[model samples]
Target: MRRREGGARTGRGVGVLRVVVVGLMVTLVGRLWFLQVVSGDRYVRAAAGVSVRTVALAPLRGQILDAAGRPLVANRTVPVVSVDGVALAHQADGGRAVLGRLAAALRQPYGRLAGKIRMCGPGVARPCWPGSPYEPIPVADAVPVQVALQITERQADFPGVTTELRPIRVYPYGRAAGHTLGYLQAGVGRDGLEAVYDRDLAGRPGRRVVAVDNAGNVTRVVGQDPATAGNSLVTSLDARIQVIAERALATALARTGGTSGAAVVLESATGRVAALAGYPGYDPSVWTGGVTAGQYAGLQLLSRAVQGQWAPGSTWKVASVAAAANAGYRLDARYGCPSGYTVGDRLFRNFGSADLGTMTMRGALVKSCDTVFYRIADELWRRGSDVPRRTATGFGFGARTGIDLPGEAVGAVPAASARPGDAANFAIGQGGVLVTPLQLARAYAALANGGTLYAPRVGERVVRPDGTTVRSIVPPVTGRLPASAATLAFIRGALSDVPRSGTASAAFKGFPFGRIAVAGKTGTAESAGHRDTSWFASFAPDPAYTVVVVLSEGGRGAQGAAPAARQIWEGIDGLRETR
Candidate 1:
């Protein structure tokens, strides 16, 4: 009976084991059906997500053209060599052997190439590619076509190396207008018009969704969007005038032994900057690949035209004379022309300490008599009015001229609490007064244009790729001079006399004034360690151009800065005759 009972239990156990085994098979079949039919598309999509990649296509940077539609800043296509970090990672020993072969072919250091391929790994120094690990890193740019061909033909050796045509920024004029047009680095603008209008110059970048393998190799292009080219920037710069200005400035600096200088020419009526030149100019192309520490350091001493500020010297006398006239000091009224004037404990002397007896205000301006202007400033200071400061501000001094280029400086003017000594100094454009070449140019332009002070402009217009005007830059009037027609006329006549028979007479001794009708002011400001800062602010009536020049540590305005201005005028004359 015990044996029979045991047999029944064993049979029941066998039956239960068979049922459990069958249930397991059925469950496996159900899961297989659900995976293969119900969720197959979802799994496939997940797999694709692991392989697909989106790449940002860089747009073609716009061309910066002069007013004549000639390109100052343009683009060139060059061959670029890139490395796939993902593919390199998949190799045995993390692509060390492959990278070694590449370094040998390219003649680059193995460690540098490795560091560029790695994505900020521990113990790796910078200049590492600041990009995704799955993306191809640019190892070399602007490489020779032969070098690119070598890598392209030897795919097996260079597993994931890519050769592509990349756009590089080019400056046709080179260092001619370097400071005005500025430079770019890694497809971004640095300074000048480049930085100010970067949004308009740098177009919208495109995108591409591509199917890539685990090795980061593009299997196929799934989707793409074409990049739009940037709009061409039409600048107010006249390339020919710019070249002439640069050559003239360079020649003057060489002749005077001056360390630095600046020259600017503006359209008197429109306030359009025709030529802006800075001494010790740099090549914008140097910023293309990358600038070295030494190369960048050299550029610091340059770019002084719109950026450098100094006392306007006698050039500020133009503003002072106008202020005096507006404040009811008669243009024809006579004042004593002494060699020096005493204000408190200080005695301010003229350029050569010459006394010309008593003379009218116009005579004072022509001779640039410091003592005559000192009396007017003293009278105004005693009355305690802001006419001097107001007059200077109205003519665009003591503030930025709102030029299109970057790094402009707003010159300083004395406050209402200024003392008689300060006022006397300010009258001669000395004391705490400061002015940039650009600011002085604008002020002189306002006088030339009959009281309209237009904010200076560099960019003229923007053009689309299809040759349509995006927008035009109309020269906006910032402020109008408070001086009336008679006051402006009197000042204009006095300025005309300056180049003809006044302080700047020696510089313009042989200049043909019949056709041009040149008018100007010469200034010499005292410096602590150097000789003086020379200045020349001039304008023409016929063709209507305002030119301002400054020489740091230069001896005399008539000798140093005036000659440069004369050369520029000669260039303008040549341009006109040719036209």
Candidate 2:
């Protein structure tokens, strides 16, 4: 009986064990079905998240070339050191140890390197990496080959460090056309043509969908879109002429003890600027890494010939002469050439207060008689006529010349309610009548081009990477001068006499007038508590180029600005001979 009872208990225990084992198998099958049918896609995406990365490929920036196709602004490739922010973040101590090791290898300050890699917050100093945390941030540019090799060879020391070749903007000419060509900051245009045509110059950036492994290494490129290089800008600037203008302006500034100076050379017929140069220019390469406070402060002294405004001084007499002619004041009419003209309590005088007794209107202009213009301004003011204002505005004064540059100053003109004193001042290009070197050049160009006022153009054409012409810039005529042919001719002939026997005669005494009929005017504007501003505006008929030079705090037009203009004209003549 005991044996039979034991056998029954054993059978029961076996049956319970079988039931438990079967239930466990059923549960496993249900979980497998749910995972395979309902959650498979989610798991697959999660797996891909660990291996896929998006890489941005920067496109090559187009070359900024001169009229002769010489590069003023360009690009070059150099090895750069980058850090993977995401991978670095995941490292111990937020990748500080690795960055510290990298700092030693790169010979860079660890604090600065760490600051650049770290995400910036409020109050963080600049030079901070501005890219996304997931993307690789370039820490060192133009890294030495040996340093890059050292970092690459010791990957264990820098888990997230990478060395690769990248394109960087270069200014081969250094400070030659720095203002006009503009400078780049972190692959962005800041000013000049670069800022004005940024969209066209900065081409589309390409992207690549890459597959990276758990070790943060690229396994394969799943998809790629090639970057398109920016279109090349063909400027109207003549590199040779630019050098000549800058040199002349610098020499004149030093000789005259002037603080600053600006010079502009334009194609008289088309109003296309050949060269725009200013003193105290800055090097564009200083912006490669980014400009510092000191560097930027130093650049504040830079002046743009097309943008900055100053009292045009006697160079303004061209407009005054045209205005008088338009108002039926005979060009040949004789007036008393006095040493000084009194208006209200102020006494305005010509250079040296030398009285030439009596002289015609043409003679008055040749000698830059301030009293003659003062009398003309008095008559116009008495008549309550806008002829003077109209004439000045007609010459594109007190307004933007529509130049192909940014931040151009639209100079101020006397208001309608201007008094006789203001009129007198305006007549001589004073009393809030300001003009840019480019504007003065444009006005002189209009006189040279038979009364057509052209909107100044700098871009000659746009071309593709293969040298195919994308589009050519057509010179646009802004307006026509109101002066008659006789008046224009009279003004032209009088201006021609200027370099012969007028204010600029001394400067152009030995110039070859037979080969080239050069016409010009000289101006000196008084500045209270400072040296007078000197000006010289001239044009050569042979090559049809208008050159305007202005020296701030320079003594006299003939002594300071005229000599500089002479140098430029001679340089232009020499250039023609060589070519």
Candidate 3:
């Protein structure tokens, strides 16, 4: 009985001990649950602050092409050497040394790279900035394939350096199509067609937030979407003709000693701008280098050829003829050229200050008779401003041509003037008259296309990647000629005679455009300081192509501008002969 009692006591003691241990374990488990589940976010953020890193993925840029599907602008992928400031923050000594070496290789100040490193930190979600990866911090953009290969070969040496492909704009034609095609910088469009179509020309930038390891090495990518590139823009410019016009126009500018010059060649039937050139052109590729404030200032300072305007000289006479012809005035209407004509208070003299006697309406254009045109202007405006204004409107003059370009200004051909003297100027395209090279082209297109003023097109078409048409331009008829068809032909015939005997005789040199019945008109206007602005508006085969040349701050229209017109006409003739 004594042994049985002792064994029972020992069993009770052992049971109590087991209960105590179980209770202790329950308390420890509850504390652990509270720390892990309830306070998880705080601890996780703390851990991520040191370990997580992110990188950016830039989208591929769109392509730019000429009318013939030729690549006027191309893309290149360059390797960029970038440093993660957050990655480099923990490794300042090593980063500083690496940056110094990179700066030396790129011949830049080390502080530039250092400043870039400071912008990126462990706090940043993504450390890859698109520009300079090292200082301003740059890795390289659209890196050369050889450099990419070199990076691949020496991948071990470049720890934080990343080599990626990004699209950059390259002008294959050099400065040939500079003003028309414009350029892309960091895939952003600037000026001309590029600026006009920026939304379609530039793609969206993408982002990827990569989760890095404890060592600042990217472990896995997370919570990021790939970037999409911008769509391409195709221009209406013909590459071959663009080159020809640029070369010829540049040569003309050099020879003329004029302030500056511009040319516009259009398909008369379709109103397609074949070539638009502004001389002393700036390279569109220079934009890719990022236009320096100095360069931008230089471009801004350039104030001739394009935005500059002068008297259209005698070219105003064509508007006079078109006005009279369209107004049911006879082409054979008789007018006598005197020593000079007195209108308002000023006396208008012939070009050489000499007088030609009696001239028929067509004969007036042949001799560019000032008195005859002055008399006609008196007749048109003498009754009222309606005749001159109506005639100018029909030819699409004194207005913006509504071209698909930026910075176009509507020239001044005021319907109502401050004085009657302004009326005299209106008849001659003088006082308060302003028009652009683009405007002149559109007006000439009207003459070429039987008075149909189609909307001018530069961006011919935009075709989407999915084989859908993004946008398409259509033809438009602004207004009809004021004259009957016969009258229009009569005016056209007078214009035709211009190349043979009038102010434009020097333009064709010896070209046989007469066989095709090319019609044209020449204009010369002089301002207060004896400044000259010369013009030639020509169209061949009725509705084919039309070209307009305007030279500002030059000599007489027939003497200075006519030679350049001849060269262009000769080019057309050569092309036509071969065809």
For candidate 3, write residues 302-328 as lDDT tens digits. 213335455665666667777776566
Count steric clashes of candidate 2.
0
Error of 1 at 457 (Å): 1.1
| Candidate 2 per-residue C-alpha lDDT over 1-579 given as tens digits, one digit per residue, 9 for 90 to 100 | 999999999999999999999999999998998898798865675677546677777788888999999998888888889998878877879888998898888887787787677665577566566665556788888888998898889899889899988888887777787888885564233788887777778888888897766666566788989999999899999999999999999999999999888999999988788999997687777776565445566674345597677888888887888889888888888898788888777887766898888888788778888889988887888789899899888888888888888878888777765555788888888878888898888989998889999889888998989999989987789888778878888888888999899988988899998777889899898887899999999988889999999999878999999999999999998999999
**Position 367, candidate 1: lDDT:** 86
> Model 3: what TM-score?
0.81
In candidate 1, what residue range of length 10 has the lowest lDDT sum?
A: 181-190
Report, for every candidate in turn, its global Cα lDDT versus the true structure.
0.85, 0.84, 0.67
Candidate closest to the true structure, highest TM-score? 2
Off by over 4 Å in 1: 1-42, 45-49, 91-128, 131-135, 186-189, 213-218, 292-294, 417-420
Q: What is the C-alpha RMSD of each candidate to the true structure, in Å?
A: 6.3, 7.7, 7.7
Better of 1 and 3 by TM-score: 1
Give candidate 3 misplaced runs (Cα > 4 Å). 1-43, 50-56, 80-98, 108-159, 184-189, 212-220, 300-308, 325-328, 379-382, 418-420, 465-468, 475-484, 514-516, 527-531, 576-579
The better candidate by lDDT, 2 or 3, is 2
